[model samples]
Target: MVKRLTKHGNSLALVIDRGVLDLLEIDADTPLSMTTDGKCLIVTPVRDPERQKQFRAALEEGHRKYGKMLKRLAD
Candidate 1:
């Protein structure tokens, strides 16, 4: 599907269609990454909130289990 960019304040925005939104399982607040691959613009959905929370919890657990060793190394 093609979309037109419209002026939004000082920036341009594209309105995504509902079908595409449903297929991507994304809402208006969903984070997106925009990059240029030489000639084309690449847009992708960023990490979901649940996955981010799980990763953070895992990192905290790892730190709790190995914090003393890390501190010793730092010293």
Candidate 2:
């Protein structure tokens, strides 16, 4: 989708669509990291490290608890 930057005070702002924001799980409170690969702009959420560690631990626990059942289901 094509978008034009809108005036925000003296700076410009890109108005992201609600659907896009929801799909990306981004909100007003989400901290974002912005960079440019020379030509294109890259925007990504800066994930919380502690939250990531918790998620990884939970995922590993789930796999350990359900690996056998999951393999059977896959077959």
* Per-residue lDDT value at 72 in model 2: 100
Cα TM-score of candidate 1 = 0.59
The 0-to-1 C-alpha lDDT of every candidate, in the order given, reads 0.92, 0.97
In model 1, where is the ten-residue run with the lowest total lDDT? Answer: 40-49
Cand. 2 TM to true fold: 0.67
**lDDT tens per residue, model 2, 33-73:** 99999999999999999999999999999999999999999
User: Model 1 residue 60 lDDT?
Assistant: 100
Superposing all C-alpha atoms, what RMSD in Å does each candidate have to the true structure? 7.7, 4.4
- Model 1 CA deviation exceeding 4 Å by range: 49-75
lDDT, model 2? 0.97
